[model samples]
Target chain A: MCIVCGCGHAEAGTGEPEHDHGHKHHHSHGSRLDFGGGPAGVSLPGLDQARILRIETDVLAENDLIAAHNRAYLSEHGILALNLVSSPGSGKTTLLVRTIADLKDRFPIAVIEGDQQTSLDTERICATGVPALQINTGKGCHLDAHMIDHALTTLAPGQGSLLLIENVGNLVCPAGFDLGEAHKVVILSVTEGEDKPLKYPNMFAAADLMILTKTDLLPYLRFDADRCIDYARRVNPKIGILRLSSETGHGLAAWYDWIEARRIPVSQQED
Target chain B: MHEMSLTNGILRILEDQARTRNFSRVRTVWLEIGTLSHVDPEAIRFCFESTSKGTIAEEACLVILEPAGQAWCLDCSQSVTVTRRGDPCPICGGFMLHVTGGEELRITELEVE
Candidate 1:
C-alpha cells in the first residue's frame, strides 16, 4: 500500500520500504515513549536538542503543488479539463458515453477514468472511438493530483482537446483534493436523496456545476428538484445547475452548450 | 477513509522537513484543523496512530487544535460563528451565510530532534 495516502497503489514519494513497527519499545500505560530522552532532549551527539519548528504548512501541500503543475501544463496546452465527481450509481459513465458520442464530431476528446479496481469504464469510453485511460486506485477512494500528473503523460491529450477525468465514484474524499481541472462537475441522480447537497456540503460547495442525472425518472420518483436546488444553492450560491437524462436524450443540448461556452478559444491555443 | 490519505500527507511533510532541516525524528506535531474543513479530528487521530508506526513520527504526540467555524451573513452584514455548513445566520436566520474561516488543515508547528 502507498504509505503516503494509504491508497492501495503506491505512486512515488520518499521510496522507503515498509517497516514492521513492532519492536522492543514497550512502555507503561502512564509513561511516555521517549526516543530522545537524552540531555537537552538530544538523541544524537552531533545534533542539538529538540526544538520547535513553526512550519505552518498545509498537510496537502505536496498534492497541491503537483496539482498546480498540472494546471499549468493543461493551461499551456489550452485543454479544457473537467473533473467529474459523483457517487456510484449516479450514471456518470453513462452520461460520459452519451456526451462523448454526441460531441465527438465537434471536438477531439480523451478520457481518464479513475476506479478502485476496474477497467470497465475505460472500455465503455473507448467504445465511443475516443482514446481513454483507466487508473485503478486499488483501495484508494479518490484520485489525487500526482496520479493525474502521471496519467497526463500516457494520455497526452492534444491541444484544445477536451479532457474529461471521471474521478472514483465518491463524494466525500474527492472534494478535498484538487485534480488541476478547470471545473469540478458533480453529478447527482434523482433516484438519490435530494438532501444529498445538505448531507455532503463540501462536495456541493467544491463543485462548479451540479448535473442532475437520470432526470427522466423524476416523474416516478418523489425527488424534489426545487428543494435539491435550494439546498445546493444554500451551500454554494454561484454553482450552476443542469438537469439531463442520458437515456431519453432530454436537456442534453444545454449540457453540450455549457461545454461549448467554456471551451478555450482556438486563438489562445499553444503547441 | 480520507483521513488515511491525510495522515500520509502529514507523514510526508514531516519527512520532507526532516530532510531539509537535518532532523532525525519527529517528537510532536501541532495541527490546526478547522471545523469546516470536512476533516474529522477523531478519525485523524486514529489514522495517525496507525500510519505513523515505523516512521520518524512513530509514537509521537499529536496535538489537534480545532478552531471555531466563522461565516459572514450577507443578510445581517456581520460575521457569526457556525458549527457546520448549511447553518443559517445566527442573527438574521438567513441562508446567505458565507464561510470565512475554520477550513484549515495545516501543520502549524513540529518538535524534532
Candidate 2:
C-alpha cells in the first residue's frame, strides 16, 4: 500500500546519496540505483491522504544553478570556457589537439576531457604539454556543471587562459545540460550526414558556433556543405559557421579569431 | 539515454522537497513536459520507474502533461503551433519560427504524505 498510489509496496533505501565530495571521489556513480518495485502493502500512517503539493520546480534547476556558478567563477577569473560537443568520431579530439598545439604558446591553455570510460583522450591532450583533466562520467551520457566545478578546482585554469571542455561526444544529451561554458561549439564532420543539424536540431539550436570539421575530406566525400549550413541556419539563423581542417591547418586562424572575438576582457569584467 | 539522468534530477528534487515539506513518501508526480523539450514522456516514465526505486519516490506514479509546441514566426509575425522542432510554420510555411513555448520540463505537483 503505497502512500500516493496504493498500487505497489515501498522499499526502504537511503534517500539522496551523498554529493560528490570533491575530485578525490571522481568515479563514484552517485544516485544511480537498480531496484525492482517491491511487493505491495507497505503502508505508512498519516501519508494516506497523499496531499498534492504544488511544487512547480524545474527538473534541471540544480544543474542550471551549478552552471551559473561555473560561469560566474570563470568570468571572475578571466577564463574563457568553451564546451565542444559533437558525435563520436567527429574529429573533435584531433581539432582540440591541433588548437592546443597552435595556441598554447600564445596563451595559457587547459583542457578537460570527458568520456564514459578511459582517459585516452586526456592522455592525448596532455601529450601536447598543456594541463588537462580527465573526467570519466562512467555510465553518464553528458557532463553536468557540478562535474566541471569540481574539475576546475584541480585543473585551476589560470587568469586570462583558455579552458576547452571536450564533452562526451554526444549531440543529443549534451544540448540540454549547460556546463557554464561561455559558448557551446558543435562539430560536424564531412563524413557524418549533411542533415545532422536537421536530425539533432536541439544541439544545433543550442550551439553558438557550428564548426564544419574535416573539410579536407570533402574532396573525397560527397558531403553537401551548403545544404548542411542551410539546415543549421534553419535551426539557428545567427549561429556562426566555420569550416576547418585540423590535418591541413586550414581555416583555423579564423576559428582562433572567432575565439578571440568572444573572449571577455579582464578590464571590462571589473565593472 | 539522458532520461535516466533527468530522472535522477527529478528524484533529487523530490528528496529535497521531502526534507523541507515534511513528507516521508511520494505517491504521484505530475510532470509537465513540452513537445519541443526533446524529452519523450514514455522514456521518462520508464526511467522514473527504475530510478525511483528504493527512494522517497519509490513506486511513484508519474503523470506527464505535454503542452503543444508554440513558436513565433518571424516571417508571419504571428504565433504558430508546432508539433515538432523542425516543423515549418503552419500559416506562412516558413522555417524562421523562433520557439516561444512548449520547452518546459518541470515537476508541477507532487502527491505526498
Candidate 3:
C-alpha cells in the first residue's frame, strides 16, 4: 500500500505498491481501470478507508481557494457581490439600471459590466450616476473569479456599496464558477420562454434567485411563467424568483427590498 | 463562447505545471466537462488548437469526458443518471431529486512529454 494513505499504491509519483498488476481488472463500469499503484503490493478493490479518502480529495482545489479568497475579500470590503448570469439579451443590464435608480437611497451602488468588447453597458450604468467599471473580456464568454478580482480592485468600491457584476451574457459558461458573490442572480426573460430553466439547467441550479425580466412584454410573448418556476424548482427548489420588468417599473420594489434585506454582516465577513 | 478564456485558463495552468514540473510540452489534456456545465466541447477544442500554439500545451490532444448528470432520488434513496438537467430521476421518476454531480467543469489531467 502507498505510505501516503493506507489505500492502494500511489500510481506514478507517490510510492504505493501495485499488487493487482496483471490481474482481472473489472469495475462496475465495463471500462479498463488503471489503479495508480507502484511496486508495493496494493489492491484498489480492497483499499483501506484512509487511502480512499485521500484519493477522493478534490482535483480542482485551486478554484475553492480562489473562491474562498473572493468571499473574504468581498466581505471585508463590504461589497455586495451579486453575480448576474443570463443568456444574451436577457435584460440583465436593464434590470441593473432600474435597480440602481430604485435603491439608490438605501445603498450606494456600483456596477461591474463584463462584455467581450464594448462599453455600451458601462455607459448605460454610468448614465444613472453610479460608479461603473467596464471589463471588456475581449472574447471571453464568461467572467471567472480572477476577472472579478481585477474588476473589484479597479472599481475600488467603498464600504456599503452594492456591486452588481453583470457577467458575460452567456447562460452556460458562467454557472459553475464562484466569483465570491453574495448571491447568483439569473435573469430569464419572458421572450426566452419558460423551458429555459430546464434547458439551461446548471445556471438555474446554481442561482440563488431567479429574475424573470420583461414581464410587461409577456403579453405579446408565449412564455409560460408557471412552467418556468416549475422547471426552476425541479432543478433547485430553494431558488427565489422575482418576475419583474425594468422598463415599466414592475416588481422592482420587491427586487430592491430583497437585496437590501439580504445584507452581509460586515463584521462577520473575513478580512 | 467563453471557451477562449477557458483555453487561456488551461494554458495558464499548463504553463505553471511546465515551470514547476520541468515539462516542455503537453501531449494530452483530459477535461471532464459536465453535461450541465454549459460549455461547448467543440468550441473549447477549436479554441484550444489556436490557444495552445506556442504555449506549453502546444499540440496537446484534447479529450473530453462527459459525466452524466446524477440526481439523488428522495423516494428511492439512490442516485440515478439523468439524460437532461432538471429532469426526474431515471430509476424512480421522482420529482424530488437532489443533484449530486455533473455541474462542474475541470481540467482533470495532462500527459506531458
Candidate 4:
C-alpha cells in the first residue's frame, strides 16, 4: 500500500496498477525465487555452476533427420546419389555431360541441377538424353532436402537411378547440409589453387571424395599437384582424391570406378 | 545463411511444445553452436531475427554457447580436447586425428511466459 493511496495491502496487486482483479499469486512462504541472471546479474536456479547449454540444435538435427530419410529413400531405390560441390566454372556441368555421354548406355543417370537462376546446366545435361531437372534456387546458395524431395518427383524417380545432385556452386553452405546423397563429391580445378582446400577446410573435410578437375590445364597453370593433395589430406585423410580432365578424357574411368565401388550394396560388398 | 530454415525448425519445435503445454509465448531460446560447425553467430542472429517474423521464437533472445571440439589422436590412442574439428591432436602431433565431438547444434532450453 502506498502512503499516498492508502491501500489495504503492501507491495501486492496485479502487475497492472489498476482496480483489484481480486486474485493474486502470493509468495506463500514470503520468499521470492530469482531467475538466473547471476552470471551477468542473470543467473537461474540450478544453473549457477552447471554447464548450461543455450543451444537451438534444431537446424542441424533437423537436417540430419531429413538426410537420414533421404539416404534410406535413395538406398532402398538402388539410387547412387552424388552431391557435387565446387567453385563456379570448375567444369561441373561439362564434366557431367562427358561422364553421361560415356556411361549413358550402362546406367540410367539423372541430374538435379541447382542454380541461382537459369536452366542452363539442366539443359546441358539434357543434351546427353539423361533425365534432368532444373532447380532454380532463386537467390538461395545451397540445396536442402525439401528441394531434392520435390526435384525427385519432378525429375525421374531416383529409385534404381544414379542421381547426381549438382548443388548451387558454393564451397561453404552446401558442405554443412546433407542433401541425402550417397556420397559427397567436391570438384576443384587446377586453376582454383592447391590452397583452395586449406582456405575452405570444411568442404574438404566433409567430402567423401575430392576431384581435381581440369587436369589437362595443369601444364599451363603453375599449380602444384602434391601440395594440393597435402592440403586436402591435412583436413580429411579419408577422402579419396581423383585427378581428372573432361577435355582429355583423363581420369574419367577412375571416377566411374570410384562411384561404382561406393554404390555396391552392403549386403554384397565384402567387409 | 540458411537461417530462415533454421528459424522455421525452431518455430516448429516451439509450436509443438507450446501446443502440448498450453504456453503462449517463448521468452528466450538457448542455442549451442559448435566450434567446428562453421556457422557465423552474427549471421544466425540476423537470420533468426529476419526469419522469425511472428513465429513462436520471434524476438526471443538467442543465447549461444560455444562447445569445445574433441579429437582422437592415432598416436596418443586417446581423445584430446581441441578448439575445432580437424585440428591436430593436442596430445600427439599426429595428422590422423579423428573428430570425436564438438559438432553440436541444438536447442537445449527455452523460457516461456
User: Judged by DockQ, which candidate is best?
Assistant: 3
In the range A1-271, model 1's lDDT, one tens digit per residue, is: 2211112223333333332211111111223333224332222234343476657789988999999999999999989999999999999999999999999998899999999997999999999999999999999999999999999999999888999999999989999999899999999999999999999999998999999999999999999999999999888877999999999999999999999999998987875
Kindly provide the TM-score of model 1 when superposed on the true structure, using C-alpha atoms: 0.86
* Candidate 1 DockQ vs. native: 0.30
Give the clashing pairs for model 3: A9-A16, A10-A16, A11-A36, A17-A40, A18-A40, A19-A42, A141-B2
Which has the greatest lDDT? 1
DockQ of each: 0.30, 0.31, 0.36, 0.26
Q: Give the CAPRI rating of model 1.
A: acceptable
Segments in model 4 whose C-alpha atoms lie over 4 Å from true places: A1-57, A265-271
Which lDDT tens digits does candidate 4 get at residues A163-205? 8889999998788888888888999999887898888887888
Which one is best on TM-score?
1
Measured by C-alpha RMSD in angstroms, how accurate is candidate 4? 11.8
Q: Give the per-residue lDDT digits (tens) of candidate 2, residues B6-113.
A: 999999999999999898999888787877886889999999998888999888888886766778899999888888777788997778988877788998667787
Pairwise DockQ winner, candidates 1 and 2: 2
Residue A49 local lDDT, model 2: 31
CAPRI rating of model 3: acceptable
Stretches of candidate 2 off by over 4 Å are: A1-50, A269-271
CA RMSD, predictions in order: 10.7, 11.9, 7.0, 11.8
Tens-digit lDDT track for model 2 on A1-271? 1212211223444232232111011111225433223221122234433375767788999999999999989988889999999999999999999999999998889999999999999999999999999999999999999999999999998888899999999999999999999999999999999999999998998899999999999999999999999899888877999999999999999999998887777677543
lDDT of each: 0.85, 0.83, 0.74, 0.74
